[model samples]
Target: MQQAPTVLHVGWMSRAVDALVRSGAEVTCAVKPADAPAARTVCARTIVVPDPTRSTDVLAGLARAGLAADAFDAVCSGLEFCLLDAAAIAGDQAGVSRALAMRDKFVQKRGVRDAGVRTADCAVLDETGAAATALPSFPQVLKPLDGGGARNTFLVADERELTAALGQPEFTAGGGPWLLEEYIPGVEFQVDGFVEGGELRLMSISRYVQNLIEVHSGGLVAHIVLPPRTHPELYAKVRALAETAFKALGHHDGVFHLEVFQHAEDGEIVFGECGARVGGGRTDEVVERAFGVRLHDVWARLATGRPSGVTSSPGHADDKVFGGMNLSARPGPVRAVPSAGEVLDRPGVVYAEVSAGPGTVLPDTTEATNLRAGLAVVSGADEREVEDRMRRLADWFAAQVAQETSDTAG
Candidate 1:
């Protein structure tokens, strides 16, 4: 009998752990103390650490747990913040460099651009609040060097807006070394897939309903998966760009979530950024439903150095379109909201998770797209139908929700 591979998974991803267990791997999870309870449920062992994204903390926790570095066949993380730590603990030098490049937007863009890929002109703003190089054009984007979920990201139209935005605490208090890039005017899209041995294994593309930065100003954060059969030319162009960017960034193996832009006028593809993990916001569910690929399971297999066992099924290449949305609400004291069961009962709604209910104080939506009132996945016969369903769902949910007014606030 063969022994199952042992995996050291960092962070607390319930789905990743479950997939690893289902793959017959002996999984041990390292997570923050607060997540230990949930980690304990799916993993054979759980090492509670103060911070799972810190390699030192994770290594020390593993030592305290009596688990040697060599005991595991792989070290992996599904969280963007923990990717570098996982790679470092795994002792994979190449993987560490790849993680670093992916985590730091400045490094990533420099490398990709040097490799002859078209990317936004960018400069690094160091601790002194000064750009390493001259600033880009008037319309520029400012974001954390290692940020995700579009948090602390800003689009400034001019010097006034830039100055005002920079005054925010996130830029002033120890948040040095930000990335300022020329704003690319185009329709944004995301490509999700797995790569192995420096080769593109599988890929899927989805067009965003609105640019993520717009989410800070009350725009909907939603997207519909584009079927390969329907958008062959688009898939080809995006795949070409993604393959080039992935190779340039040295992302040899792992699941990747890449964002790119299609030039609004010239239709040229421009690389935005990439992550060494699955895309967030119901991406895994939408991809599986549209392409018949379970990304979590694929991640597990790739992390364990096993074949991905993922193959595009021609049968799934029908006209059926799938989409996902991060339900949003205005900042206020929530009065009433629908339950997950109620949302699931709606036609065309395949998956629903209602995170906010009555009494939940919804914070300002400017923080991140992940800070949602709820999330839902819908399916339709085509893109138009899926989009309509998404709008209807959003409107219906908003109408059902009531926020407490000043007079009602006791």
Candidate 2:
């Protein structure tokens, strides 16, 4: 029998590591010390690094572990922060370039625009915290070049708001050169899929319950998958957009989580941004349940220079539409919250994870979209049914959670 391929997996995605092992590969994980324990449980070997996001740290850790770059047949990371580092270690110049395009918002949008794709007009902020070009219009967006989860992202409606935002400590302190973009007013949709050898093998699109920008104002972060059969025109547009954007960004092989906007008025699809990794939250779970394909499995195979087992025709196990929700708590001392089992037992609920419960203290501020107290995946026979179930689940969860009263404050 052929010897299993030796793979050096970076970061700490348990699912990806598990997929690599299941694919007959001997996986060696390079992860931060905090994740070493969990990595050991799944990988054949583990190299502890102080920080996986830093290429120097990862390189030094590997050397101390007595391993060379040639020791592994492939190097890959499922985490956003570690993508460029993994590419550098693997000596994949193409991968490095592609990773940069995906990580830096300005570079990403520029490339997509150059490819004749419609995207938000953006410019890089200079050292004085001023846009290098004139602002596109009011309701402009300001965000870190490499930020994720909508953290440090701002929507300034006018000059006064922009001035206030620019004076904020997060912007003034450091982390120079942010990206300023004209906010695209539309319904946001995400396209999740795998591209191999410059060809899109599988694609799935989902519509967000609300735009991500609303998260700052106490909005729930959730989305429902759109079945292709029900929305063929949307699927076609999204698929073409994804393929064009990926090709422009030089991402030939890997999983992608791409965000796009459909103009609220003209209904024209515009590129929002894209990530050369799996979507966040329970997106993988929702996709797998809806389409019967594990994105991580496809990513692992592509990383190892093997053929992705995914075919053009993704066979769905059932006709149920799926969706995911990030459970958030109001700022306070949590008195009680529903258990994961309680949530999973509900009708159409397939998966649930409750991280906040009795005695948990939630912070007053919400900065990121992924700052969840828990998560859940639900399914129904159609989009409306799935959406209704998601809203009901959210309401039910809120009703179950009890916060400490002001009188109880110590």
Candidate 3:
């Protein structure tokens, strides 16, 4: 334990490398050959595998990188799609089975239900059913059994809609297995939680202003913590639900992100899905800004078998955030761009980044990939300040697009 623990991180390069390195871990990444350059810039060493999604292939490549059966102290994957592979490999390193349970949606969900955690009723659908009698009810959700975010995730109202959804490019491209579930109608919330030494601690919960579907469909992305006045009760509910999921999945170590819903009709809380990794989006950023402890640090320590390095912070931003928002330019010409310099000048603005320049072409707001034009990670004196700043920044972005488009038309 005196030496820096070597961590073999599987999947795409991400902020995790920096966090683990800062924690004194020697980081080596096993990534797709195409991602080797980016991974090398961040990771201490890189091992390029032909296809990172295939666990067996990655293990073969890791062997080529001189990775032995006991080569590393810990193993993990950053990308959701690669978690399954990360887990399979982690089993060789950690000699544990936490990886498989959390890798497949079908397996993960069934485990939860068997353990008595409430989840959306679901069925595995590997092939399309008769269009006339496909669903037992309307408003069913169809998604890949192992995909993340809202990729090919569709809410269908009836049989005709089911056929239409099945035909969409996203669904068809998901390839192979699928899951159809009763659409849970409720207030959606994403929870970032940690489980260490068999104990589950809810770290951050951000309520989404737009359901993931809307956010992924291309538009604005926003998530804010609840005011402390209502946080205690809400936090308790989310924590209870998360703990149940952690135990059900045998998640004894590391961090997890849980997707949950508060049923709008029955006022009951239920699970949507959960990840054995940090939830995507600026979640890690929001959690760090609000809490002051970097999530990456915690994850690295956990994966490397080191004690946690985080000092817990207030559930809600003690004095900082109303929430965080990512502003996206609509699909079109980026004739003009907003100045991050001006945004920094605004009071209560904690962080901001504008990713486009004049003549930068923007794709139509249709997915998370296109939401990167303008991004703001905010923390203010209070909720009102955060809200007002977000609105103002959003307006400036819209105005920039409008004026640019008008000039072009003229």
Candidate 4:
């Protein structure tokens, strides 16, 4: 009997692993040794990663314990994790030599731009002082060159903010480095898709609406609402440009996530950044809802050499409306908490997950939108229905927490 095609996923559990499993592949997970339990729960095999937490041993250990060349058919990463890109290529050296370029902001843009693709002006700022020298544009974006999940990203409206942001301990290099670029003002959208044998297969398009601009304008904490109601032409532009970016990255197979800015007035689409894996935080879930296409399933099958039997794009007219929204209660010392059952029962709340427990000290609201005490994923027949459900769910959640606190007081 033929061996079950083996697939390897890297670093942390995500919706992508579930997608891959449903596609009929034996999955292995690669994670930091300490996180083995979580990784094993998600896959049959687990490979411990190089502990890069310390300054002295960061990249050196990774170089020492890299994967063998003949390990797995395909290797994948999630949540802006770049090590998977390195490991996948390490597993299949010749087939994936150019893979790591996708994770480095400067290299990725330079390569894409050299290939004649349209991209925002960007440069890697190795030193904080160099930021002012490398690109003098105010209202710039500062980010870790190899980071993921919208963390440590900042929008500097002026030189002072840029200076202050650069001064933050988080903004400084942590073994790796950061990037600064001209702030591309426009509506943001993400392209989630995959490449098979050099062919680009489009999956889904998501529009992002950020509630507040803090250090990271990229919704450090924000909501992803699918089936953007207002931008049809802009969506088309993003799709086309996304295809161009895929080719420019020299990526021949696997999932790709590209974030872009479409200037509402000029219709120009600027590439902000990209990753060489599936998007994180239930992105595929929302895509599956709005388009009736499962990106996770396709990604999984490809890892195991199973053909993605997907034949067409989600029919544009599907009547079922889907929306995924995430929000957190106002930040402070959480004086009270609600039971998960109660949050789930609120009208219009299809699914809800709270990350904080009572007495959890919620972080300060640097970004008005992503100060998430928790998140709720809801769907409906239309946007209004989703919004209404979200509002009711929010109200219900607030009331429940209040009651919990009141009861405790009594």
TM-score of each prediction = 0.94, 0.95, 0.88, 0.79
* Pairs that clash in candidate 1: none
What lDDT does model 3 reach?
A: 0.72
**Clash pairs detected, candidate 2:** none
TM-score of 3: 0.88
What is the C-alpha RMSD, rounded to one decimal, of candidate 4?
4.5
How many pairs collide in each candidate, listed in order?
Answer: 0, 0, 2, 4
- Compared with the true structure, all predictions reach lDDT values of 0.85, 0.85, 0.72, 0.62
Pitting candidate 1 against candidate 3, the one with the higher TM-score is: 1
**Candidate with the larger TM-score of 1 and 4:** 1
Show the lowest summed lDDT stretch of 10 residues, model 4: 52-61
lDDT of 1 by residue, 290-387 (tens): 77888898898887888788664323547678888988777788988889999998768999998898889987876788888988999899888888
Model 3, residue pairs in steric clash: 331-363, 331-364
TM-score of candidate 4 on Cα atoms, chains taken together: 0.79
Q: What are the runs in model 4 whose C-alpha is more than 4 Å off?
A: 1-3, 47-71, 82-91, 94-96, 171-176, 211-232, 330-335, 359-372, 384-410
Tens digit per residue, CA lDDT, model 4, 96-123: 4465567778888888788767777887
**What is candidate 1's TM-score against the reference?**
0.94
